[model samples]
Target: MSNEQAWEAVVVSKSRAPLDGSNLYRRVTVRHDDGPEEKIRVAREAWKQIEVGDRVMKEAGQDPRRA
Candidate 1:
């Protein structure tokens, strides 16, 4: 993968789970642009901004962004 290129994918599912018995961890499952399923961890705000069927993109070193 090229650092300058971004991977674009569609959201398949989203979830939130408990961490350390108190904190919440948010994640999204996506059908990747390259044809594999991957889970991406996201910030609370970003997770709220996405839903099933929403589009997202990921750069080499950053969190997924809503598209």
Candidate 2:
């Protein structure tokens, strides 16, 4: 991650689904700064803090954070 760049994206959607039985998998679909829409798996708390239209930032090794 030496060449990591900080970039921002807009959250378009969020979802959660069962992972196995009791656990769940959460994800968010974002429109990137570079012009692509991508779905990224995120932690429960992070997912909770995010909403559609929120801007998120990604800086290499770090997980995307609400901006």
User: Model 1, 52: alpha-carbon shift in Å?
Assistant: 0.5
> Residue 10 error for model 2, in Å?
0.2
**Which stretch of 10 consecutive residues in model 2 shows the poorest summed lDDT?**
1-10
Q: What is the C-alpha RMSD of each candidate to the true structure, in Å?
A: 2.7, 2.9
lDDT scores for all predictions? Answer: 0.87, 0.86
lDDT of 1 by residue, 31-63 (tens): 987789887788999998999999999787777
lDDT of 2 by residue, 1-67 (tens): 1326666899999999996888899999999877999888888889999999999988877888899
Deviation in Å, model 1, residue 23 alpha carbon = 1.8
Note the residue pairs that clash in candidate 1: none
Q: List the residue pairs that clash in candidate 2.
A: none
